[model samples]
Target: MKLLLWLLLFVLCWPLALLALLLWPLLWLLSLPFRLIGISVEAVFALLRALLLLPARLLGHRGS
Candidate 1:
């Protein structure tokens, strides 16, 4: 009885498992460029913010 139940579960899930396997690579390829662009934009914003703050920080310094 347990063996039969296991077989039924396996049969039901097999298609879903195969679908995920097939789609994994395609999804990864599609998202690759978007991920890289997001990272690049984040880096540029951080650099710009740092540059903008540098002058304020230097001007606020007291020459004691």
Candidate 2:
């Protein structure tokens, strides 16, 4: 519903929509580095968690 209103506004004010379209790619490009850093940080944390759990997993497998 909100999207429909926005589209209506865009139709009524085309220049605003055009400006938003032009800036979208630039904004995404600027944010790409931060996104990459976030992904790397998440991966590092996942690896650390797996390392921490390895001993427990091995013990469980031996018992089974």
For all predicted structures, in order, the TM-scores are 0.69, 0.71
lDDT of 2 by residue, 11-63 (tens): 88998878999999999999999999999999999899889888988888543
* Model 1 spans > 4 angstroms off: 1-5, 56-64
Q: 1-64 in candidate 1: lDDT tens per residue?
A: 9999999999999999999999999999999999999999999998998898888778895433
Provide the global lDDT of candidate 2 against the true structure: 0.91
Clashing pairs in 1: none
lDDT of all predictions, in order shown? 0.93, 0.91
